[model samples]
Target: MESIWVGERVRVRGIEPEESELLMEFDQDSTFMRNNDRLHPPRSKAGYRHYLESGVGTPNDDEFGAGIESLADRRLVGWFGTNGIDKNSGVFSYGIAIGTDFQRRGYASETIVLLLRYMFGERRFQKCDVEVYAYNTASLNLHQKLGFVEEGRRRRSQYFAGEYHDVVLMGMTIEEYAAAYSLGTVESS
Candidate 1:
């Protein structure tokens, strides 16, 4: 689907082949890598191409990736989308990574709000899941502030930066999203 979901500060659009280099830059960013857990080693150009095409075959065959754009200047600041999706179960897992320069802005929150509206209102998803490293307090706060609850945690489940870190699992059901953000007013945001 060629759809662009726009929010007040950011917009989400489908990934383009020409933007592979930009995606590579994010992958190589040290700060971005620290907050996220990578399942595979760093990818080369060809590898990223395959990833862009296949989404590493997470949970199910269906996957979606979109570039996060700044609405003020129309620049690509990051990417976010679901790599793990199970339509039959009405559940999906998603993640987001903002470029170092783009952090602290409201782009991540705006993108997430738009994503939830699309997933819950249009796609009919029952819930959305996310995993964040304990060290990443900003991410944890963001999810919680957006109405996601702490479903569980895997203590010291991830090894990064020469030490083990707890993995915080967070989820928000459609009911929660509706309560936090009314579907009728989401478009105006």
Candidate 2:
């Protein structure tokens, strides 16, 4: 997260070459994997490495840039990015760990707010979307609080662990995004 910004308690940065170990730590956490079922499993360290390097390093064909960072205690907390949705559409997805110590302290909201601002204001993207496990109420509420509408749902989409799970697609358009968020207020200095 060295390339990204550091707020009072959060550090956001592009996942870099040095953060390979972080991926290993993440793989060890079943709690993280269970919630984020949309992510594909890493077959090997090499695959994870390729993903990490592709996320925010160099210039990929469609990926503008992405970041992974810590929220509190300076640990690997989450990852977010402006990935290509269709052709020029900018789709975004984030996976955040509130941490064993720092759960439910508005960190995820803050991070999403920051991400939305950057994606809509700076990147000039027309839309932003996220996929969440339908059973995750906290995550579902968070997306709602951030003004994302329930775009759609895929029935029995994901079969994680031992059960079938549905994936919910949520989205906020650039129009709704700008009106719903107060990014313009911050720039009026």
Candidate 3:
């Protein structure tokens, strides 16, 4: 699980203290967090330091980064990871965000695909889930493209921009992931 994952022209490696600055790709960028319903707000450098240390500080925790060629020579682009794992039920949640400079290139979707493969195929998790704001078309589209189905809607759950917003819950079980990825179904384009 510590080995770096390479796919879709990017590399995903376990998070490190070096990646503490790297986390700004997800934490400080509000636009990136738009689709990530469960993420807490952006934090200052010290705040982000504490946050990353507690969440993925352990080498065994499996938090990782998805990065590509440098902005100039070679720069880390973004990150994605899992959390809230219920070991007994094998259910867990996920988060992802590409850098503002590196987004819209299928990186987020690819990250989810690679991570889902690791979770369902390698780790044999029973299910994996993610939540998105109801209005986030990109995130909703990405989740469905990966075979996650709508599970429920949690109404009026978040307050932002001086108003409340509803959130949608979606999930995919190992069976669904296997069926979509393992079978290699020809998805409609």
Candidate 4:
């Protein structure tokens, strides 16, 4: 399938069934798993294949997954997409995770921008929201830098690593996204 979204450094595409093993590897990443809250146990190859297949042709699926491929080397650097998409309200929550080897290379930011463009410009989403743990300062700063306004916070709601952390909620409207990147004017690399 053709890429759904393309950025200067990466492209967003659906996760293929053959890539199930790759996702299983990502699930085994200790550092990546630690940062994000894991509600379920790690998945086996077969389990992950089922998970990936479930999203196919399901427009209103609670969690939609996409693969982030680096344009430079055509490697799978990350996985991300919208979760909890409300069709009627045009609102959705997003989550992203880049492999440890791919961290600090600006792939997250580029991937996020491309996802926003697709959501606002193509999907016509009214608002995009994200919840981040307070301990993830880098993500908080990145969201703010991308123009997501801090809407609210839940005080010490998440317990991880033997400490309670606040969950910060941030959001951005389509208008705000337009103002930030000018949508169609972004030059692809």
On TM-score, the leading prediction is 4
Per-residue lDDT of model 3, residues 1-189, tens digit only: 223255645666545556667776455666566555445655777766776667543545444433343323345667665787787898888777667767677777766777877776666578987888888887788788878999999999987656688888999998888777752233355
Clashes of 4: 0
Candidate 2, residues 1-189, lDDT tens digits: the string is 232245555666666656666666666667666775434555576766776666444544335444534554566666554443464556555455443334466666777777677666766667777888899888899889889899899989888678898889998888887787655433232
RMSD of each candidate relative to the true structure: 4.1, 4.2, 6.0, 3.7
TM-score of 3: 0.76
Better by TM-score, candidate 4 or 1: 4
Query: In candidate 3, which residue pairs clash?
Result: 70-74, 70-75
Per-model TM-score, in order, reads 0.83, 0.72, 0.76, 0.83
For each predicted model, how many residue pairs clash, with residues at least 3 apart or on different chains?
Answer: 0, 1, 2, 0
* Winner of 1 and 2 under TM-score: 1
What residue runs in model 2 are displaced by over 4 Å at the alpha carbon? Answer: 1-8, 38-72, 87-102, 184-189
Which candidate do you rate higher for TM-score, 2 or 4? Answer: 4
**Cα deviation in Å at residue 114, candidate 2?**
1.5
User: Deviation in angstroms for 143 in model 4?
Assistant: 0.9
Report every candidate's CA lDDT.
Answer: 0.80, 0.65, 0.68, 0.80
